[model samples]
Target: MERTLSSELNTQQVSSKSAMPLRLLANLLQWQRRMASRHQLARLDSRLLADAGISEAQRFSELNKPFWR
Candidate 1:
């Protein structure tokens, strides 16, 4: 029983370690997407901004946010 428990714990630890890279990749992708969206948001003209119901202040707020956020 002890051996079985130890083996299971080891497997779980290995699985979690393997998942870390995938998690970091996912986070990097998300940050990239956030950066792209913020860039597009910054390019919007006043008319488009109004149409989208986004104020200049709101756009500034979003644009100023860190990609990690």
Candidate 2:
């Protein structure tokens, strides 16, 4: 009975540890999708940029900036 309990505890601990990486991967995927969307928006013409109140200079800056920033 004690061995069974210990095994179950170990299983739970392993699952808990794995959960973190899974969550991180999910977050990474979400950020990737958002970055793609941002790039698509940035590709728009100057008229759209003006309508969005985002200047060409700002768009250029954002395009050059790192994704993490």
Candidate 3:
């Protein structure tokens, strides 16, 4: 019974360890997507920005932000 418990704990630890890299990858992907969207937002014309209900000030704010934010 004690050996079984130890093996289970070890398995849990291994799984959690493996999850760290996946989490980092997910975060990086999200940041990359944010960067791309910001780039597109920067290219928007006044008409398109008005259609999207975004003001020039809002677009400027978003464009100036860091990708990680």
Best by TM-score: 1
Q: How many backbone clashes does candidate 1 have?
A: 0
Once model 3 is optimally superposed onto the true structure by TM-score, how far is the C-alpha of residue 26 displaced, in angstroms? 0.5
Q: What is the C-alpha lDDT of each candidate?
A: 0.96, 0.83, 0.95
Q: Model 2: runs farther than 4 Å from truth?
A: 1-16
Q: How many residue pairs clash in all the candidates, one count each?
A: 0, 0, 0
TM-score list, all predictions: 0.94, 0.59, 0.86
Error of 1 at 6 (Å): 0.4
- Model 1, 62: alpha-carbon shift in Å? 0.3
Model 3 agreement with the true structure over 5-69: per-residue lDDT tens digits: 88999999999999999999999999999999999998899999999999999998999898999
**Regions of candidate 1 where Cα sits further than 4 Å from its true position:** 1-3
> Candidate 2 — what's its lDDT?
0.83
TM-score of model 3 (CA atoms): 0.86
TM-score winner, 1 or 2: 1
Q: Give candidates' CA RMSD values in order.
A: 1.9, 3.6, 1.9
Worst 10 residues of 2 by lDDT: 60-69
